[model samples]
Target chain A: MSRQALAELFSRCRAENRAALLPYMTAGLPDPEGSVRLFVAMAEAGADGFEVGIPYADPLMDGPVIQAAGDRALAAGSGVEVALDILEQVVAETGRPSVVMTYVNPVLRMGPEVFAQRLSQAGASGAIIADLPVDEALPFASALDRHGMGLVLFVAPTTTEARLENVVQASPPFVYGVAELGVTGERDMASSHIGSLVARVRKHSEVPVVAGVGIATPDQARSAAAAADGVIVGSALVRRVMEADTVDAAEDALRVAVGELADAIRRD
Target chain B: MRLDRPDNQGRFAEYGGQFAPETLMPALEELETEFAKAWDDPGFHNELNKLLADFVGRPTPVYRAERLSDQLGIDLYLKREDLAHTGAHKINNTMGQALLTKRMGKNRVIAETGAGQHGVATATACALLGQECVVYMGEKDIERQALNVQRMRMLGTEVRPVTSGAGTLKDAVSAAMRDWVATVDTTHYIIGSVVGPHPFPWMVRELQKVIGEELQEQMDGSQRPHPDVIVACVGGGSNAMGIFYPYVGSDVRLVGVEAAGYGLETGEHGASLVAGSPGVIHGSMTYLLQDVQGQILEAHSISAGLDYPGVGPEHAYFKDRQLVEYTSITDEEAVEAVNLLASVEGIIPALETAHALAWIAKEADSLRGQTVALNLSGRGDKDVQQIIDLVDADE
Candidate 1:
């Protein structure tokens, strides 16, 4: 998928008075079929986009909830190929855009060219290489672009203005603004200076900016959406899925959370 | 006689192999080639020897422990590596690898440190070589060894505190390895000990052989050409191997001592050589203290130097060949030896080295008529304040 396609999806979410959105969940978490069902359910519940996490042995940026989910996925013998297969099933069921979120090791292990080809063939909308800095991303970025897949770049709160500009220049899709200095989690969002951060990133790029990392409640989602074009909620949604007594309970909790967030963003 | 028997596939007696990710295969292969060439290069040896003598303050003293020996009724000698620059034997290996990294054209040095000794050593070399240095340390270690953290910062090295996986040495190593894999082009990971994948154990052991080599020359000049027994503490076993390698075929009995923590039978210990079973961890098949399901268990020791779950593959080889006898010393014994040596010999020993001292004290009666050489691997200067504080706390 092209940058234009992602922008179009964001536009539709905004036109519908909803948050231009993405929800992240580790693939094969709990179980393969259940995780796939949740992904399809989230898309059906009006999630504009999805980030399918390829579980890793060391997910350095993840919080306890996501880490536990990833551990469950890995223990179940889930890998990048398994994650892609699940994504394929979700895409076939929901027909919504999905991106593969992973650290650079698995991609490097699979070979960049092969990874790009496999992602494109699996119908993934884009790829987010979390640990690949712009200085070291040329090879992977070029391969993704060659395979007609968008390479989403993460701009952290600690990133300098010069580095932010470099990231904007290197990014193929929307710039993902990490909401904090640390990993993903359900943190108190009262002190987040996301509005100023979004403004700074907006000055550097023409692309949409999506705020993520520690966004949990509908209030935080609305606050993030007020500043940026999109709000990405990961750890909170992952926690709900993991803590739910059953798959149906998980889907219900996710639908209610997404609905509340959608309404909060749509409010004038 | 060669102790390292690389199989046809280049394994070290079922212990060593290239277990790194495929992304590092080419680089590892390149390192293997460069190392083979450098091992044979007279110029490389000359440079390393010069650096060892000038930079590292090598030929570290072979001081006879008069007071301690007199008390135990035995002749005792100490290999004073504590006097080496940077306060330990760790710098010897770091300087060698940093020089090799420079020769390989790598512009940066990255390493994982346990007790911060290795971090300081690597940072010192990086500062001298004008290479960018980043040291990964566990968060827990940074808090415990705050002085070393400041030392690294003062040396202009970036010290990254890894907060993952219980925040200890093992996690620090995992993080460093991941960083090395990602930044292979511009980075060289200087492994702190004789652990990790192939080439590290071989490289570190070769660099550290100076301890044994110097001991040989020093003994030759003295009345006794060789001691009846050689004792050294084994963490990852570099220091022990350094003092033991040259005497492998000799009549000198080699003894490796490991930390017993509370006690070896309590399952709360770092005695990999004594209480551990054979297993694979961090790319080497060595004796590891692992759980029933094969997961590596966290090791416990009052001394950070001994807090490792597995030993180096070379030590494993020696143990299997029965060339060396491995044993354990309890925390109480180690502490007693520390105080005993300090009061009797005017030399404070590192807690890790105290394990060897403790073992020597126990076996002193049996070995009374014979001379024994002990590797005082590092001075207790870095550990002195902590030891005093602990003693006072107990009192």
Candidate 2:
């Protein structure tokens, strides 16, 4: 259901002549109920899709802000099951395709087939395993295929030509192009070189190319969406949600913030 | 006996794959290619052997521990890795990797440290080769191994302290890996174990295999026939791999002793092989001390070196194949073994090595007719301060 829902989403956005605006959230962060509230507001504010994060003990690719959020989520006892639950709630309420962003260990522990089955049952459109390298993504990729779900793979500026081709070929639903060379953090703008990377990805992939990691502002999202099919905003909205004092405050801040980002993404 | 492993994908049985981010995959592939080429080149081996003999004082003497043997009613031989320069077998891997770094045209090196032995050794290698070195050590380890921290800095290497995840060896490894991911083009990550992704586990083992090679030749020359048993302590299991590689298919029995901390039954131990389930940590799938939810549990041990939650993937393979007997020793038992070795043989072993000594002591009476070989992996000078505190408290 989510596989076709995700494809329909991209096509619908394409027909509307605007790029999709995807927002990311670390599940159970700040507080469980607060995270749910924030996600609901993001959906209402015009997020085209969602990428719900599952916290791990060690998140090597995340910067200080996201790492702190993950710490908070883990402290709240929001294990993998809770993250899945949050994804289900987000998809149910919003009726938009959602993906779970997680590291590979948790997926490996749950057994790929079981994890895939549960995520598909929960209505997740796809998953982005931040650390599952191309060489090791095969078994999990196959499992996701059986459940008719997507496995979003990453391509960086430093990714070699041969490896980039492999990533483009293997990835489904969309290709997540890292906007900069560093780990995920809130930067003033995306890397200027992302246009060339998106072009390189475009040569091999017909699926939408979604740029992420370091896209922080409306201007950055606008510029990023100009070169790619869409933009996935993570740290920017997450940072706002993190700074808000309460659930209501977080939802309010996220509502206004997501509206700006969504409007900006539609410009190109 | 000849040893072969890591079938093309760098896996030892079901363990050991490159489970890294996409950005790091190319670098790992590059390393794998370089290592394979270098290992085949005679020139590389020539340079490495030269350093091992002249600089590291390789072919370290194997001495008969007659006094301890008499006390235990067994014939015991100790491979004197304690006499190696920088005071442990760690230099062997560092030296080899430093040479590889130069060959790869990488002028900068980064490493993760636990007990600080690998750090001191890596710093020494970089200083010798004129390569810029950075070592990440757990904050708690930097506190416990103060002398080694000073030694690393004094050798002109930058020591970065890691404050994540129980502040121990596992955290240090995670930090080093993150650094490598961002700086992969100019830096060679000198992983200080036989437990990391691909090429590293195989590379470190091949470099450290000199220990088992020399042991084989030395034992052949000695009056005592082939030893019935061999033992070494395992943290990331480098030294054990070093001594066990050359004897893979032989008749000799091999044992790896892990730090049990308080006790394995109490669940405050680093004996992953004995008490852990299979899980991935630090890029390789291996036996890990993880909870039911797959969250890696912090390990505990008096020995900073062996206080880790994971073991080398090859060791896991060995354990499954029944090729190696994996066991554990508690902190109290290891400390007692340290005192016994000092009093009987006048050689103070590092707390890590004392774990193996404790195992030997326990099984000595049963193997009275057979000869046992143990790798005294390091000298206890670096550990003297910590041991002194423990002893004084006991008094």
Candidate 3:
């Protein structure tokens, strides 16, 4: 059911001849109440779907912006349960298919089956474990599948073609293709290597490929959108939310960034 | 005893596995393949043995601590890893890994340090081999281990200070792993302990098992060549694993001592084996100090080397199997043990090593007349300033 919902969203975007604009926000970040408000506002501002980040202590793959935001969410008493609660609300209230993004440790600690069951119960579409390798995706993938939710896998520019075939074989709702070599952060432009990575991913599976990391500006997002099926905007919007002094102002700034990114991916 | 470990997927009976990011998977796989080939290659062993003898001054002596043994009423033998180059058993693994780095055609190595012994050792090996060396240390550790920082710089290493998460070993590990993710092609992350993902725990243990092999050979003619008890300090559990691996199926008792900062009751300690729950940290599923919500809590210890929040996953497996018994020693007691060993045996032990000595001191009455081999893991020359401050406070 959840996989179908995500697939329909992707199909709808393809029919419209635009890449899906998936805006990411750390769940319960800054504060639980404010984060929910921001998620709702971004949804209204034309975000095609939501990628709600479940804050973890050691976010090795995150840059300063997302890490700081995650720290704030954790400090504000947002544990795994709270993050799931917020994820449920974002999907329910915004009426958009939402995916929970987190490191693998939390899921492992929570018991993968239980965690998957909770996500399914929470109305989440799927999950993207940033640190879980495709080879080690068995128990996790099987558990999520039992709940009719997808486990998204990653394909990096550094990924070898042989490994790319293995990753695509897992059959995720989409492949998360990293745009650059480093962690998640905004850059002035996307790496040209992403186009080749997406093309390589296409050779193995028919799954939609979404490129993320280092995409900040709308032009960068537009370029990333051209290479893949969709583009994920995270750090750029997260930084705007963090830099704003007031919660209201943070919400406004996030909505504006989402609007421009959504517009960038849209076909004229 | 024929010990079967780390099944096909690197799981040490559901404990150890490669629990890292997607990007690092290929590198880890490559490392595993290379390590397996190197282990089977006699030429690789010959080169590593030559380095161990010439560069690291291996075959480290086991001294009978007569005075301390008499005082404690036990036949105590000290495996003097302190005598090794870079002042610890850490050099053993570093030398082996550095050679592997060369074999892999990687010219740069990245490492993380807490007390800086591993950093110094890694820097030394990289210098000898002409490889670029970068060491990541937590900012707080940089303040405490300043002298080692200078030593590292003098030896042509770049010490990058990490200011994240409690500013300690766990954070340094996180930073090093992040660096590896970005530079996996040109750099090999020389993890400083028997921790992290699959091949690391297995590779480091195999590299360090030389300590046990030597001790067994040295005691070949002794009445009690097989000791009744083998004790060592556990920080990511490298030294303990090294010393304990050879005697696994024997009648020998393996004991690991963790640091209890104030007391176990006070909840400010690095005694993960004693008080921690099972969780994943720094790549492997292990015992770690984590809250109910799975956020890793900061572990505190006066000894910087033992102040990490997690223990190696293999140690966790042993603890669960009743193969090894783990306990804790407080800071005050460990400090006294340091002073006692220095005065009685004329040997200053690293604070991390002192914890093992401290445990023997407490258990002397019950362990009377039994042969106890304690791993004196490192020398305390680098711990002079920290010891001075403690002594000053005492006076």
**Model 1, span A26-127: residue lDDT tens:** 999768878888987787676877899998755646666887787778778677888989888877787778889987656755778988888888778788
lDDT of 2 at B199: 76
The Cα local distance difference test for each model comes to 0.80, 0.88, 0.89
DockQ values, each candidate: 0.04, 0.69, 0.66
> Interface root mean square deviation of every model, in Å?
10.6, 1.3, 1.3
Name model 2 segments beyond 4 Å from true.
Answer: B1-3, B221-224, B392-395
lDDT of 2 by residue, B149-183 (tens): 99999999999989877889988988888888778
The global Cα lDDT (0 to 1) of model 2 is 0.88
Go through the candidates in order and give the clash count of each.
0, 0, 0
What are the RMSD figures for all models against the true structure? Answer: 10.6, 1.8, 1.5
Best by DockQ: 2
Candidate 2 residue pairs in backbone clash? none
User: How high is the lDDT of residue B130 in model 1?
Assistant: 98
> Model 2 chain B — which ten-residue stretch has the worst lDDT?
B1-10
What candidate 3 gets wrong by more than 4 Å, as runs, is B1-5, B223-225, B393-395
Better of 1 and 3 by TM-score: 3
Q: What DockQ results for candidate 2? A: 0.69
TM-scores of the candidates are: 0.67, 0.96, 0.98
Query: In model 3, which residue pairs have backbone atoms overlapping below 3 Å?
Result: none
